[model samples]
Target: MRALHIITGLGVGGAEQQLRLLLRHLPADCDVVTLTNPGAVADGLAADGVRVVHLGMGGNRDLAALPRLVRVIRAGGYDLVHTHLYRACVYGRLAARVAGVRAVVATEHSLGDSQMEGRRLTAGVRALYLASERLGSATVAVSEAVAERLKRWGVPAPRIEVVPNGIELDRFRFDRERRTRTRRRLGLPEGAFVVGGVGRLARGKRFDVLVHALARLPEDHWLLLVGGGPEEHVLRRTAHEAGVAGRVLFTGERPCAPDGSPGPDLPSLTSAMDLLASPSAEEAFGLAAVEALASGLPVLYTSCPAIEDLPAAAATDARRVRGGPEAYARAIAEVRAAGPGPRTAPPAAHHYSITRSTARLMDVYAAALAGSSPSLAPLGASPS
Candidate 1:
């Protein structure tokens, strides 16, 4: 089936990167339209022979662009329109309806009661979201936590589907050679204890908390911040004020490759890390933590819905520590004392593999096209 994927921006964030990965596995002829700033992800999509359209949306209030979006959807003869992130969900769903597309679906990649995309949650935003949501055939939540959150947001239970984000396990598998090379490339000393976190450096990500925690660690401990955002200067200042400025390394924004063959390979970076931290209280699925686990690195996270939901065997390497710099410091020390377990694939790896997620998403597409309205069953198993 012909599908059009719509997203807020093509920047290097979790949702954007996930869309790039999903395209690699989906068999349907799919194209992407970025609402604004078709950044790095757009180039990657174009490299893979997928068309990337820039809508040039002026701002959130650019309702005037809806007719143009509708025209494009209609002219493309798209059988399905799949929207990602918030703005795209709102506008794309409306456009799809206006274009008379047979089916429209959206992936709620990031949402919580407190915030979305680092912005404080407000009633007006919820009203806008719900109003646009009604136009789509289905809304896919990235985790069970997100699904329940949507329900609490007033969406009918039948309209929310759980489809956990997936990772390409083979790409993230531990490789000593890559560890050596990536560490060398990043100028990290061979014996330093490196703790890394991957995602946009946004306020909601709570990367500032990681800086404070790093300051509490031993002298040999270092921090690696990946991805870039408007908060970089603030985070850098936080690092300086924490007295760990010299110990902190920022890799700027790294392009995530679906096969991990090009750009700054995420798996390689994960390999270079001694530990992975996800201090964000707003994480939806924590794909980076899962990739770290797949890379055989122990993870310290404040919030990880998919990891928490995973069966114990599958999540043996992840720990959900209490929020605070001290708690994270203690968790890091404890993990260091225990050292790492045998390096092997976590038992739960297969469940979150790209192969399985792709199949489940295809099922959602098929269901949407079947004119299944109102009641929709959740896909993906509840974490065991």
Candidate 2:
């Protein structure tokens, strides 16, 4: 089967990373097409021998690039088209219809209730997204919270499917020696405790809360902020103002697991940490938190819907804090004192592993190809 996956930019993010994982694990007989210009994840996908079609979409809402996408989908003769992110979901579905593809599916990776720049603009986008839902043969949501939000926004329940995000367990497994090496390479003291946070330095991520929480922690505590965004400077200033600037390390957007060589740098980075902190006010699925748990590190996150949907064991390691700095600081101290428990293996490997998740995704593709209607099962229902 030929599958075409569409996404906005190939920048490093949870959705983009998951797309690459799906492409890499798809069956050898399945042809995978990725539509995005060369970026961080492109090289990784290409390295896996996945055919990538770069449309050079400058940014979201590129009307000019629609023809190129439509043309490519037609020429590739894709049996199924799966799209991620808002822009790709909208344009990819429309283009797939234009290309006469048999099935078109989209994965909703964010909550629909989020307010963009202005109320009017947000409403318009929501309307457009709702309309696009009709074109999709099926709609997949990374979390139940996200699916519920879509239903509340007027999407038909039959078209929605809740598929929790998955990870590569082998890649994120606990490794003591690798942790030691990573800490040593990063110049961190062996005895120091590291709390890592990975996400864009944006408003929704709430990096300021993390910086403030770090300020309240003991001097021995360290914070590692991985990922980049427009708010990097603002977050740095917040740390400086909070007097914890020296304690925090900002490693801007590291290259993703390009060659998949156990990604010593990426996995080691998460493993070296004693815990992961996700202060985001919004998240469709906490992929980073799951990665941390897989690496045997507990996580402390905000009381967001997405984090709440994590498995009970994984959620137990997570402390839900309010948005303010003081609440975050208290939660940090509590988690630090608790230390990380023995890494509880998450549910079935299929629930979160790339190989399993991609197989389940193929089932969705098969149903779509057969023209079977979509079904919205309960939060944890098996895709099979």
The lDDT of each candidate is 0.85, 0.73
Predictions: Cα RMSD each? 5.7, 5.9
TM-score of 1: 0.93
- Tell me the deviation in Å of residue 236 in model 2: 1.8
> What tens digits encode model 2's per-residue C-alpha lDDT throughout 1-384?
877888876766667777777666677343334455557677666776777777877666567777787778777777888888777888888888777788888988766356422123377788998887788888998778788888888888987887777777877777889888888877887688888988777777888877888888889989999888889999888888889888888888776654463222467788788888888766767777777767767777773454576556545566666667788777777777876677554553225676667777778777888884442211221111
lDDT (10s digit) by residue, model 1, range 108-188? 998976987666779999999998888888899999989989999999898788888988898888888988998898888
Model 2 Cα shift for residue 194 (angstroms): 1.2
Give TM-scores for every candidate, taking all chains together and pairing residue i with residue i: 0.93, 0.88
